[model samples]
Target: MFRWDGGPVAGGFAPAPAADALRQWRSPDGGLWLAAWGAEHRGTYTGWCVDAEAGLVLVADASLYDRDGLQSALGLAGPVLDAPTLLLRGYQRWGEGLPQRLDGDFAFVVCDLRKRCVFAASDPMGMRPLFHRLLPGGGFAFATAPEALAACTGLDARIPESRLLEPLFNAEQLAHFEPEITGIQRLLAAQWLRADARDVQVQRYWTPGQTRPALASTDVDGWVEALRWHLGEAVRKRLADGVRAGVMFSGGLDSSAVLALGCGYVPAGRLQAYSVLDRGNPACPETRAIDRVLAATGVPATCIDVADMQEQAAGALDALAASPRFVSGRNGFLPLFDRMAAASGVDVMMNGIDADALFFYEDLLERQIRAGGYAVALRCARKQDRMAGEAWMVPLVRRLRYTAHLPPVVRNGVRRWRGRASEWPRLHAALLRTDACEALGLRARARRHLALLRRPPPPAGGLPTQTLHGAVNLDGIGRFHARSRHFGVEMRCPFLDRALIDFAAWIPLELRLRNGHLKWILRKAMTPHLPHAVAWRGDKFHPGSHFDRVMLQPVLEQVVRDFHGSGPAIGRWIDRGRFLAAAQRWQAGQIEAVWELKMLLLLEHWLQHNADKVAFGR
Candidate 1:
């Protein structure tokens, strides 16, 4: 938080903040104010508050997964050290290099009073959250939660329509759009922000390209051997002492792999696992695969029924309304999950957030097409067919379409065709007021943003994989942290560990994905530990399936009623008449539209709840 050097504004700063301000730090000069609040994680150091000199102050909301790795890098040893102390020492030693030298889920700000500038960074995968705002005259404010900055006495807390249109336009690529722009401006993953009195600048400190192995090798078994070591160490690092850690088990390969590997470190009797089961929805049932892990490992598990949480919908909306950050996920069950964690005395939660992106195999054909020409791309496509024990032409055709040999027009035409083919049902045309959308140039702006995703991957980075790192990875992390923080639990992902990412970064794409398989190397590495059914599973659960199955009927009804009548907040951006007709269909049991409608409802509630805090530019 930033404040006036002194005077009435300084005194107005809250002496005791409500739920939003979990911890607080103020500059002695009365020019800056910073705070952290919420369910503080029990074991891991989050840099809740840092001890620093008068001119230099650093506050961090971080949970380092690889503390041992960081300690080894910093040359610290012996007894376990305080998280803040270790963090401050590293920051003081390496400055901006601190992010590169560390591996964890963190977002922190270092204020240089002497230089009159500030430096900020998020974890490589963006597991933690941070937001900043430039004030009217001078000075700036940053916080883990946007609400903290919105609560500032002097800062302009008006809502920006562009922020709302971002997720609407880009779909899942919201985090990749602009590292500095969200509902409020947000820092991108592996990127850092620096601000001075005159200006603010955001720069990338690290990228997957920077970590490509010194010697790239295509040996599959060799790659698997290395992955096993790195992946094991990654899971072990998160098994910190004293805390009762739990895995967010979904019975999928990624989470199952994490659970299997984690059992080696945590004893079966002490092991804990949690899964969100939809007892009511046959379409999205929790697979018996989870039972296999529990039975094999003897790890105790807890299952929560989404059916029980319909009553909490209002409270969830109220929570979403209170925060200024755009909640990108459609999951309506996290609030209940967190409450369960809190009740069960679980402090740290581990998940398999980016295993798919890390081990992406579908992009292999494209990568070969770009680098080794059509012949090479065809060979890979054939290899994929052979591995799958079938003749397949789709991979070959898809690879050829994206090759460098193709004209820009041809490539773009293919992309546009595919994009159109995959386009989800959007809000009805009548739902958006043409005058308002035109005034904001909503369609034009959305087109400009969508075009960015079509550009070729950098020469040094993997195709689509690099794009994943910059785009969805950043957005997903912020959403995860927001949901976790709401219940005061710290979430960690082992697959995102620096060592694992570095290893996965340089391995040949064919080894990562083959024969229509994704994360192929990961499956091979964990085959010994995971069940054959899980290791060989081919299908992925759509992210919205569970939410659609459980909450669609109830949530949609409430949102439709609210949208057509009392919820005029979203009307500022959407066309009310169009939305009303769509809502009618949604109400009449045409539930396929639930996914799109829930998003609008979330946006509507967000706008309505924070109406006073927002100022339209009109």
Candidate 2:
């Protein structure tokens, strides 16, 4: 605990100049030392705050959407306070209840000197990352990004053993494990923490359920219209007053919806689409859809051909080799950010990141079938299939097991007969050592991953589908936010807005996946504004018939080549012979997936680059 009265201090407070972040403002009585750094863009300030009189110092990576509303509620009347100051004032009035009254993507920490307590929280969607560790003597350390936090108190900057323990080659599995960084604990979406001299506590501040009962009562057409209205309002709140805006478009429903709605808010010629054109792949997924959206919307866009993607992966990997700690998928997008910086174009880039996972609840469909017999479920399934452009028999056959629900025994048997126990196939193929699977309990972990996938919707809702999918996809969103900010571009995902996600919870399942389609509700709502090609697109184009294997071949190669130098950090977890064999196949472009490569590379990078910090035998 920090000492207010000059007694013998257990652990002292001071700033590390070498940390290169978190400038300190010392208390008059040396009771606390607060460090803060902030970004000020177009009159919005998100980074730093200190209210000496109130005994609270705030450090945040934030974007407050409803500044006026929050200010009015807090009864503050004056020149607009910076985001951090407004939040501190919110804390002053609401205390730990402050985050509930707030909106937007943010991660913040408030050190209260008078109370001798530290408080920290993140936005419900985890668009911004927050990692911290409570110290033994009630001290604490945190960093928005990992590299800077390595030497701070209460963190271990080494690869977690579970990371090496599990050989993750599946994309979904990799995404699940991606954010389990070494050392500091990442506060998940909707989570907050409090610490004092006595002990520390962490808990969720959000209560999940349909946000608007009135909106939920509306008919299909009425709700669809309401979706459009709510969506436009969401986009408007995210846009800066006079800054240019762009959507990270993929010719998909979610981004298309964002682009369509976002256009209404961004000035003409000021809205752009940052697109990736899948070239050299005959199955070019986005080319046609991109063209249609561009033509229909008449908005300017910058498209990059995959053929023009040259050696950017290598540079990003090399940057990792030079820095310690893990960097997420954002490292792979350095080239895109580079291009944006070169054009000196958009200051804010929006994306459809979580819209895919957040829009619908898969298990809700299963529950619907189980609760109602086949006859009723058949009708509901037909309605969904008809709307989604799918054959009625498809959804019907997949769900027939639920029809035997009259007898619990028969129903259980029928379901068991319909599906095998969920497990990762070829899990051993990822291990270098044959016994590693049994030795590490990898099979059990795989089952848990499957269980996460098959998890039913939370009775209430807080983006159940995404949250239940093992990892909240926070790995991607958090890294994207950190990296974009690193390049001085404010990244916003309107889909991750707490308000929008809450609105999604109330949406009917039939509306979300009509006609064999996903994101059906969003597609229908944006149909008038988006080109039909993009609005009703069936699937996203996967370059090289694979996701990252081809696009990031250079980075993969760099990771594989670096494998020759794998030390105990990697050697302890992965089987060298087995992993290298796969790497050899990957080098020849013969492998379809190499999801484990990035995780290995992250561990290898930290071990090699942070040689001074590593203590394998300690």
In order, candidate lDDTs are 0.65, 0.62
Give candidate 2's error at residue 312 in angstroms: 4.7
Residue-by-residue lDDT tens digits, candidate 1, 1-618: 554333212434442347544555566666766654544577655444445554667777776665776777788889756666677778878988888877677788887766767888888877777777786647767766665565663445554565455565444454444432333677767788888877778888876635555444656777887888888888887875656778888888888888888888976455588776665555542455766776776778877555565555454555565554446455655555665676687777888887877876345556656665456446555655654456674556464665656666787788776655443223233245666667766555545445655655334445225644745566676777677766667777888886677667777766765554657788888899887767766644433344443444554566557665666566667766667667776766565556546666666656656666544653
> What's the TM-score of each model vs. the native?
0.80, 0.78
Question: Candidate 2 overall Cα lDDT vs. reference?
Answer: 0.62
Clashes of each: 8, 7
Across 463-487, the per-residue lDDT of candidate 2 in tens digits comes to 3334422353655676566666665
Provide the lowest-lDDT 10-residue window in model 2: 4-13
Give each prediction's root-mean-square deviation over alpha carbons.
4.9, 5.4
